[model samples]
Target: MIWKEARNLYVNKWILFEAIEAYSEDGKRIVKDLSVINAYDDGKEALKEYREKHKKDKSREMYVYHTKNDELIIEERMWMGVRKNG
Candidate 1:
């Protein structure tokens, strides 16, 4: 998974003062998104929940936390080709 966030921090009065003006014209600070990659089963479950929760969105976003074991599951949709070939 990849996430990003934006922050507002400045030093010089020139930059800071200019930023204040820009913020007033536009908007507030942006979110600073920090993301994590899960390698364990718990993380996979979290990903599952994320997928389910965001199901209603027109476009879904996902981070492939754990897919190898999922691919091995003998399910109808995914295993049909392998079974037929075998």
Candidate 2:
């Protein structure tokens, strides 16, 4: 879901997630279309849960952000690519 939708749904909460996306032919994932993995309340308990989950798989793209910051969340992106030799 988009951050705006998520914000309306999860007010005063923190969301932790890894995006579900499609990969390109060159093996790069397209992040514009992302599905949230884990959604948790923003609290000490949630922090503990995030820590445990993050430790198990460090490669997972995880983020802890508040619903209030919808703009920031929506704009966030991870750039991944290697420059080709000329």
Candidate topping TM-score: 2
lDDT of 1 by residue, 1-86 (tens): 11211111211111000111111112322212323322334554665656664575525322332332222111122224444453
Per-prediction TM-score, please?
Answer: 0.24, 0.56
Global CA lDDT computed for model 2: 0.62
State the lDDT of candidate 2 residue by residue for 1-86, as single tens digits.
Answer: 65677677777777765565534444444344444555676466566777898899888765566776746333434779998999
- Residue 29, model 1, lDDT: 28
The parts of candidate 2 lying over 4 Å away from their true place are: 21-31, 37-41, 73-86
Q: What lDDT, from 0 to 1, does candidate 1 have? A: 0.28
Candidate with the greatest lDDT versus the true structure: 2
Residue pairs in clash, model 2? none
After superposition, which runs of candidate 1 have C-alpha atoms over 4 Å from their true positions?
1-41, 66-86
Local distance difference test values of all predictions, in order: 0.28, 0.62
